[model samples]
Target: MFTLIYITASSVDESASIGRKLVEERLAACVNIIPSIRSIYHWEGSMEEDEESALIVKTSHELTPQIIKRVRELHSYDNPCIISIPITGGSRDYLEWLDDEVKRP
Candidate 1:
């Protein structure tokens, strides 16, 4: 199974760093970084807003746990936003390519 992990980072540089590490380590096949995004949420009983970067990681289900753990280790926020969504369907060629890029368990 394939999955997409959506992670929010403090800045583009940070996002790029994390993304690159994941790809280099074969924990992720690819990563798409959105340089800027506006985020609003509640934290520690307070509402907050900030500009952040969004990192979308493509990998396999088996790698999701390790990805999350690694991201937490590299992240700045105490509770970073890391959410994984299953890829139920996609182009067969692309999926196959992704599978090839990442290591299998």
Candidate 2:
């Protein structure tokens, strides 16, 4: 099964950096980074709002744990948002490519 991992980073540079690391390590097949996003959510004891970058990462379901671990290690935020959702369906060729991209040697 495939998975789509959603992560929010403090900046575009940070998001791209994490994406590159994940791809380079074969933990993720692809990562689409959204440069500008306005995020509003509760944190600690108050509501918080900030401009952030969002990353949509693609990988196999089996690699979820590793991806999360790596994201945390590279992420600047003390508690970053890293959520994964199952990819139930997609184009065959694209899915195959995604599989190959993250395949372990």
Candidate 3:
């Protein structure tokens, strides 16, 4: 099983740091950083808006909890967005590559 974990951070540097850590620790196969994302939501009983960076993480389903834990530990936001959607399908070669990259010992 595989999953695509999506997390939004406050800055590009933070996002990159998270990505780097995940890859370095062998928790994720790959991470794509999308910067300058505009987010609008209700906060503190008021409508608020801000800019953020999105990290798209590719890894095994079993690793999602560890990934989320690490993200929470490193994140700046009190409530960071850490969502995982199961990968229903993908290219066989790419998926194989992903599997190889994130294999746990």
Candidate 4:
């Protein structure tokens, strides 16, 4: 089973660092880094806004837990955003490629 994990990081460096780590560990097939995202949310009873980077990670469901754990360990935020959405459909070849990219040696 495959999944799309979405996470928001406080800075571009953190996002890139995490992306590199995941790909190196075969925990993620690919990670798309989107920069300069504006986020507005309530925190500590106050509305706040900040610029953030979004990381869209492609990986298998079997690796979600480990991915989440690593993200939390490396994240700077007190409560970082880590969400996973199951991939219900995709091209067979692309899916196969994703599988191969994340496979352990």
Leading candidate by TM-score = 1
RMSD of each: 0.8, 1.2, 1.1, 1.5
| Candidate 4 local lDDT, residue 64 | 91
**What tens-digit string does per-residue lDDT give for candidate 2 at 13-105?**
999999999999999999999999999998888999999999999999999989888899999988899999999998999999999999663
Model 4: residues with Cα > 4 Å off, grouped in runs: none
By TM-score, how accurate is candidate 4? Answer: 0.94
Per-model TM-score versus the true fold: 0.96, 0.95, 0.95, 0.94
Error of 2 at 14 (Å): 0.4
Listed per model in order, the count of residue pairs whose N, CA or C atoms clash below 3 Å is 0, 0, 0, 0
lDDT (0 to 1) per candidate: 0.96, 0.94, 0.93, 0.92
Clashing pairs in 4: none
- Over 4 Å off, model 3: none
**Candidate 3: tens digits of C-alpha lDDT, residues 18-102:** 9999999999999999987999999989999999999999999999889989899989987799999999998999999999998
* Predicted candidate 1 versus true structure: per-residue lDDT over 1-105, tens digit per residue: 999999999999999999999999999999999999999999889999999999999999999999999999999998899999999999999999999999876
TM-score of 2: 0.95
Positional deviation of residue 19's Cα in model 4 after best superposition, in angstroms: 0.6
